[model samples]
Target: MMKALRAALLGMALAIGLPSGSQAQTLRVGMAAQDVGRLDPHFATSTIDRVAVGWMFNGLVRFPPGSIDPAAIEPDLAERWESGADGRTWTFFLRRGVQFHGGFGELTADDVVFSLRKSAAAATSAFSADFRAFESVEAVDPYTVRIVLRENVPSLLGILTNYSGGYIVSKRAVEQKGEGFARAPVGTGPFALQGVTPNQSAELVAHAGYFRGKPQIAGISYRFIPSDASRDLAFQNKELDLNYGRADQTWATRVRALPGVTVDVFEPAELAMLHLNITQAPFNDIRVRQAMAHAVNRAELSRWRGPDVSRPGQSLVPRGYLGFTAENGLPGHDVAKAKALLAEAGYPNGLTIKVIHTQLPEMLNMMQVVQQQLRRAGITLDLQVVEHATFHQQIRQDLSPLVYYSAARFPVADIYLSQFFHGRSIVKTPTAVTNFSHCNQADAQIDAARVSTDPAAQLKLWAEAQRTLVKEVCAVPLVETLLVFARRDTLDYGYKLVGSMGLGPQITEQSRLR
Candidate 1:
């Protein structure tokens, strides 16, 4: 009876657009997700999971709240750090009097060592591929941590910044709760995870003992509203102070016109790519893969997605990323040439291939656009649409012949190339990452770029790798879609929204509703 009454009241609130007094004290956010996959920072890859974990965890160092530049990284849990002359060994001095949430005790080098080691272990972390250079991590003392790399890297600080596989977790909490830590994580950030209500919401309270300062907002309510209409309706009704906005000009213009609403079309564009499985039958031929490439029209797709929110992707590495180059060795679109190539590959009438795709609105719509474009070139796509989570699982298991995936990484060429195109990251392998295309031709260039000391040398090697990948037709780079979000103008995040590696606005201790 009470549940029905609450629903009735919520419906009435939606109709009347009632403003809640309690909501002013707590920032309510609506995300397009059914639920968070994992709260554990090590395994949180989805936008919803990454956003929640970003608030609850801190790294030794961090990029400024709204930035992803490696040069802008500043001290967080670690006050200072020094690298050895060879750049192989580094030491970090921990901040004193830092407390972990949920009574996990004070932050120390022990927790840092544990968290980093866990991050490097392939058995424990999803991002273990990025830590291939780590030789060892140790606690020099309770307040000092030392890391030894096997070789010099382009930017050691880039890997240590607060992001995927770099977030520090409470050692004691993880050991005490074991696998239960995913449900209730402990960190030394400004916010603490309170609890999670399945398929509904996750609540986080401000950490009183945060090293920086106490958070201005009392708490955060992360509500899961999967439908675009429902999320927008909730925001219109004032139930949501901020919500994930659609990445389209129509949606942005519409939302910006709403009273007190501000739309943010931020940086770190996620590159949408079409990875053709070379191990599969039809795509095994280089001619077929080339045909697939020629069939994709980046401009048409970008126009369909919206020019303000997206741009034509031209390189393997995303634009604005370090070492990105537009000299990718790929030909321009030629439908006639594509059909000729198909005929030469013994598919005179073209071929049909089954593709497992996600039902997520943004991705689904992008695939549909690609589908129509491919149809013009006489290529038929048998799209098998499934739930978002199921799509991820199936694709990882190598069930999809053509995989349309989108991602925004640490804004480095090495991270993108090593994860998406390197042989070690090939699916169904011992060191499996996201190398869905099984492209190993550019492995040497990618590896060389990682250890190259000179900036010019590193960029050259990265450029060479991208050229090789494009020539191989391993994956067709599509539109680079920027992130979009909407918030009430009165809510202050205390930092300018530029580029967030976490893919959301980083709410900090100073964020508040005025």
Candidate 2:
């Protein structure tokens, strides 16, 4: 069925006389996922969906290939943009002749308005919290978009980069496809999502009308091979050109030694942390929360993850992100101190906490290590492990008292602090994002930093925010794990691997499978 679907999609490409359709190479790639969660750019929160939607969409601006630095943002759908004197308004000039996939017609300001508006609406986007400052998005003309913010932000360009809530969708395509758009998305990117074969695989075809130029490869065969052993075997058997690698020292080292294989370990690293719900019982007491913090051994967790692909987490805000600070003054690992705190919190005989954990290999492994560590400190985790997708749903529904979440956001302190610690982002709320800790202690500092024009002042506020979050024992910072990927040496990504916001190696028009 997967092969037939691929063939049918390719047949349609050939029938339409797409450039190099008959001879262009199709790069076979395997991912560590059961299946894609959502392809709608507005709701593509999972790594698998991000990897797919990224190829099928473009934003007003984009982080340069192989970089996630804020300074490296370059024009994409919008050729040029300028900010108002007050820094509250931004005007973007859309590129002419740019076309959307699936004959959705030319890219215009109307689509930009619709996409941005949709991204800011809580009902439509998973990342709507990222756009809380947006007052309005208006189509000034056929090729001009004007965005007004309620207050000054750290970087307006940051919000326009090709990331969560940034990818633009065609107005006509979105309205026409409606909910079906997740399976069949339309955008102005180098590749088009041709078809999805359920749990099997997804087929992408090179967009002949791509503004950048026709893609070097014919397309990508994105396969969902969840098992490490199965995916590794398929890659070794030369059935897959590339595959997501286990992001541990052992796996990375072993894979790098394989014949004709190259392993890439790149940033920004995903920060794994234990969010203790302060609003819940047991954890409602600050002593109990501190006990959990002291129970965690960040160094041991980092060592287990392997120093080659991970580092001990220093702060709630991920390292390498702007405004991050290691001077958070968190409680270090001390089993004796942890036990004392638990006893003081009226859990003298230790406490059993129920947690809903994800069964995803990397996440599960990390959580298992934490469970053992907690057990040593007189805490037993009654882990109710579920499939990854179900875990996400249940966690958001506030079913988990202890949420061990690992994620990488747009390398910014504001985004990280606001989404993870803001009051408005508390889970089970009308405007919820990912405040698993249900912490609002640092709201003042976080809010102050967002509107601060002075860079030093913003950094100071962010530093204060981190310290407050830590002092309040909102979460126990664990380890920062880098992204690991193994690929055939014959494949050329056309650029150096460094950092990717898309959570995977991005295939561009220049990438080739030779």
Candidate 3:
């Protein structure tokens, strides 16, 4: 029965020339990896899925055309916004005449309130924590909504701009359909969800009455090709209009040489780190953690890929982050110091530790190189490579003592710090589901910074918290990632590298070849 259904869907997709069924001008996007499961905007935590949801939904506020900075919030559904002097109350004036797709009619303040409240509701979202700071959301009139907060949140606006926090759904639609509404979301965005095939692809069509104006492109067909090689091949064959995420530098160069292909490189606000489980024996001692940090030769790691690939990561926050400086003062490699620390930790003869790596070829290579460097300092590492999903599960369960992982963040330091180091963050699980390094003080400082309002004061607090985490060796910083997008050069689209993920508003604004 399932096979028959899939065949029918594929037949439909082929018959229409694509799932969107619009040949007038359809943009077909290729992704380097498959989405990490759910398509519901509120449940999307990974960059891969966020790109897809970015097209299917509209938030109260959005990042401007070329800017990914959360600080530069722009009007989306809401036309104007203001906050009280205390910064505890925020008021947003919704734009009238905006209507949801599928004949839902007009948008109002109540819909705004419903969307925001629903995202914060415990039963509906995994990211409720992002909005937990809010005290209440109320509709003042048909076109005005007011939000009251328990305290002054300096990053409240930034949080609201997050993909997970901003994707607004129709109140009436959700109420009518309940849980199934996520699969068929109704919004005031340029595109309307048309169909979805679990683990396959999702299709959307241009909404004729989009508030900004109808997109020049008739529709979008988002294909879910998990393999980077497959995506590259598709682009080479002119089967896709755009591709997201990085690819092999060599392959990227070749694609760039192709006629009509455009390759863009941008610095991503994400870092790949080697996180240690502090609850375990070897890493429990600060001396042992410091030894691991000092043993790594960051120069060699930086050179693993070409200059365009990565930058040496110096702090928890990436280099371009606000308040980041070279002199924030974190310890660096010193072979002698590493040896002395190892001896002090009662491992004078060195110790053998297991290093878990995800299935990504690049990450696995990185781990192997790290293993070689650690061996030079008398520390032996046993490499264990697993599928990405399994690796994440093991880490969340605290089943792995050491794991290679990456954390993506916006241009701000507050949300990044809170989600990783805060005691209550999902990343810091407590049971078999716990990934906490068991660094209690680090968690406390992160929590404190969340409520801090002064930018200067907040930076100082965050710097201290990061330094504390580094000094304790909770996570060893490796490299700040770069955004690498490969295309067939024939497509003309604009992309920006402003945030952690290097996607832009081009998906909603660009025209495609007929």
Give all candidates' CA lDDT scores. 0.87, 0.90, 0.69
The digit string of per-residue lDDT tens for model 2 on 1-514 reads 5467557656665665554533476789998888888899998877878888888889999998889988989999999999889999899999999999888899989999999999999889999998999999999999999999999988888888999999999999989988999888898888998888777789899898899987877788999888889999999999899899887899998988998899999988999999999989989999999999999999999889898999999999999899999888988899999999999889899999999998788888889999999999999999998877888889999998899998999888999999999998999898999999999999999999999999999999999999999999999999999999999998999999898999999899888877
- The alpha-carbon lDDT assigned to residue 271 of candidate 2 equals 95
Where is model 2 more than 4 Å wrong at Cα? 1-10, 16-23
Stretches of candidate 1 off by over 4 Å are: 1-24
Error of 1 at 43 (Å): 0.8
User: Given candidate 1, what's the lDDT at residue 93?
Assistant: 98
Candidate with better lDDT, 1 vs 2: 2
Show pairs that collide, candidate 1.
none
Q: Give the lDDT ranking, best first.
A: 2, 1, 3
Residue 423, candidate 3: alpha-carbon lDDT: 59
True lDDT of residue 164, candidate 1: 86
Stretches off by above 4 angstroms in model 3 are 1-23, 34-36, 103-105, 121-123, 173-184, 245-249, 335-340, 343-357, 360-372, 375-394, 426-435, 443-448, 494-506
Question: Higher lDDT: candidate 1 or 3?
Answer: 1
Which digits, one per residue and each the tens of the lDDT, describe model 3 over residues 249-320?
A: 565566778888777666454577777777787888889888889998776777665566677888866777
